[model samples]
Target: MDATQPELKRALGLLSLTLYGLGTIIGAGIYVLVGAVADRSGMSAPLAFLLAGVLAAFTGLSYAELGQRLPEAAGAAAYAREGFKSHWMGRIAGFLTLAVAMVAAASVARGGAGYLLTMIDIPLPIASGGVIVLFTVLACWGVKESVYAAGAMTVIEVGGLLAVIVIGGPALADLGVRLPDIWPADLNGWGGVMGGAFLAFFAFAGFENIVNMAEETQDVGRTLPRAVVLSIIISAVLYMLVILIAVLSVAPDLLAQSDAPLCLVVDCEKSTMAFFAPVALIATLNGVLIEIVLMARVAYGMARRGWLPKLLSDVHAGRRTPLKATLAVGAIVFALTSFVEFQVLAKATSAMLLLVFLVVNLALIRLKQVDPAPHLAFRVPNWAPVAGAFSSILLLGAEVLA
Candidate 1:
């Protein structure tokens, strides 16, 4: 092994890093998974989302604490390694993080293709495959360039969601439309809400992606935690508003039926909200770009730590980017998109992420007890990590049992 390790450029500031986190958190899940959540939780979808946000907050705090302690790429894996004192455990956590990103990218690619079909007539494979290739090149170009592109798309997507809220504002004002029962009285009432929360949890999955870019962020110990927390808070607010408006604007059954749920929020005849299809396309592609960037960084970080083959750590001389790792991630994403259906890919991604969160929260708790950081810029209450770990385990159990 070479004595010296390659390093990623530290060019991202708080704004850029926060934007990256927002882009990642708001991407694929809201664009595609909202309808799926509606299907599971019916009128109670908003409540389910609220529960998911609370659950995510617990884990998010844990990540923020760990980010201050060990601001590294492959964040989850690094946490596991430091906490457990096992290189093998770190490798496993790192690979799981990579798997979640790849699966999620593929899932979003498939959903993006569906939205593309609504805008223009094209074969599904072509639409999905084209995005995978395009975003792969963008991700490989440079970190700053890729993140800038993602930030712009994030604005457009957020605008799209806001448009839905604005268009549905009148509908929300009308008290005649019956709101969904907050708590279902049916036999499967609580069970269904839990199932919905499990799905909604996937929407909040991308905040952790921020920590994986710690190596590429300026003042990571301070900047990363803020970005992680702020991004989650912002996304949670937007998600709740969108879900509430969606349930009120359109019937739950109708919302669940459409591939493009938000587009259906406005009156098709009265409003020219057809532009939303393109917005959805941008949102999903942005997600693909962010995930590809994250996967590459995880590979680069692991290889630098000698957990992966050293070749993956190779950087472009001029670009100073992880070119080899980027290409590797792109290839895997392309293959996954080609074969996997969106629903299966999404469930797999969510399940894997929940497991990763479970392990990550546990790592934080163990590290606090066994190898406390000497100088953490930010600290969480001692009970925070403990609650984070137990909540994550409970959520993971719910997913498995369901």
Candidate 2:
């Protein structure tokens, strides 16, 4: 049987697409990157996040362009296939993209378990593995159910962060604006701020996941670019605000020391709100898990298209989920979880994602020149793709340098 003939449903709307994008982008970075960013950027953590967001915006535009032209699942892989006309290269691009995604999910899973363990004094590995398995099971049930769960979780995730902002507003105001000492005499110099930008960019990484949903999203030609651009901007702004609050509410040094910086800052001022830590952790986990599920689906889609090994293309007849690909990815995530630390996992994911983004921008530029689909539902000015391609190349260089 021709694999593509076994059609999957396309039931997602613009709102569902946006929620998935938002949820995936907003996770672990806010929970996990605060201290890492604070330590690297000093008082300039928000600035770093802002810069990273700007960099990510360029690539986001590139994705918007290709998503319209290809408008299929396995977003980057599809783009690569069309852009380069090489199935082998497309497979490599798609595989690395999905690999980083699984690595990210496992990293967050372990981190969530650590938070759970610390919160309740349970064994870390066992708790983390259990959570990962449960999330994978949920993903294998069906995309329809996953979309609803993802949308609901995104709301709670956003609310949890907002709750922190509201509860910490007074504390932040009391502290006044504590800028990271940019001057050499005060703290980390300019070099450190750039380094922090590298770290902060991770928070904005999920926008690419939007590309993978092109096959399932409603009105792909019109909605994908706008959704991609808007989601990237919205999530970046929220990250900036949250980091800014954390930076100002507590001393930078103190904020950098804890694993849970936002909660620690909140706890410092109003210990009564300590109950929200696990809530935040759950929010982050849900977001990461959703993205991983999306990644696995993308992998399965690619395999079905013959871009990957046939083994990964199989869908369970009963559930119609990409059970084979899901298990393969889960196994890789578990292996990496055992061996790697969060910093390594995050940076590696960033590096792999940067490569995919580079290709996406290139594909957009090439597609514009070769195909020139002026009637695309989402059209950027012709020059935007050029600029987006150039900027993405530069950032990819920087990602490598970092």
How accurate locally, in lDDT, is each candidate? 0.85, 0.73
Clashing pairs in 2: 43-180
Model 2 lDDT per residue over 1-402, tens place: 263545556677778888888888887888778888888878777777887888888778778877778777687888888888888768877887887688778667655553465477776666666766777778878777887787788888788788778866775554343333432334335556667777777778788888777766777877777778778877876786688788777777877887667777567335677567677777768855686577777888788787777877776777766777877776666566666677787777777777777777677777777888867777666676566566556655655565
User: TM-scores, in order shown?
Assistant: 0.96, 0.91
Each model's RMSD to truth, in Å?
1.8, 2.7
In model 1, state the lDDT of residue 14: 91
Across 1-402, the per-residue lDDT of candidate 1 in tens digits comes to 354545778989999999999999887788777788899889888888898899889889999988878888778999999888889889889999999999998988887775777778878878778888998898888999999999999999889888877877776675345554655777587777888888888889899999888878998888989998999999998998888888877788887887877777765434476778888889888898999999999998899898888899888877878899999999999898888888788888878888888888888888888766667888887788778777777777877787
Candidate 1, run of 10 with poorest lDDT: 174-183
Best by lDDT: 1
Q: What is the lDDT of residue 49 in candidate 1?
A: 89
- Number of clashing residue pairs, candidate 1: 0
